[model samples]
Target: MAVGLWLVGRRAATTNQPQLATWRLTLALPCLALPCLALPCLALPCLALPCLGSWLLALGSWFLMSDLDA
Candidate 1:
């Protein structure tokens, strides 16, 4: 989980286009969702925690970058 979050944070750091990043995250949902439907109990945490954490990290990175630009 830490490794995955670290990768997400690094990606968020390098990503210059916020809109593109938003779109990519949006697009990833269905891809994550379909697998979760197969095994709800096992997949929920697998789908939810990392996804939510990574997204929050992405948003935080975006906000921080915007703050720096201001």
Candidate 2:
């Protein structure tokens, strides 16, 4: 969902539509927070691996791509 919104924002930016890009990027903020909010769920054995793996992946991607907009 965050990726989708980011893509939409990028497309909007490429098309010279700043307003649409801003809105799409703004909406993606909450989606990005999902992994952080779910961190506490890692305490459950059943969710440990999956949750940790996804959280790590999201964190890695965030760090790697964070400079794209700069």
lDDT string for model 1 (1-70, tens) is 3354346556866876556545445544544554533334234533655565666799899999999999
List pairs with backbone clashes in candidate 1: none
User: What lDDT tens digits, residue by residue, belong to model 2 across residues 1-70?
Assistant: 5566668888888999989888655544443555564334423424544665777899899988987866
Clashing residue pairs in all predictions, respectively, total 0, 0
lDDT of 2: 0.63
Predictions: Cα RMSD each: 16.6, 15.3
- In model 2, what lDDT does residue 13 have? 84
The clash number for model 1 is 0
What is the Å distance of residue 7 in model 1 from its true position?
A: 37
Best by the lDDT measure: 2
TM-score of each: 0.36, 0.39
Give the best candidate by TM-score: 2
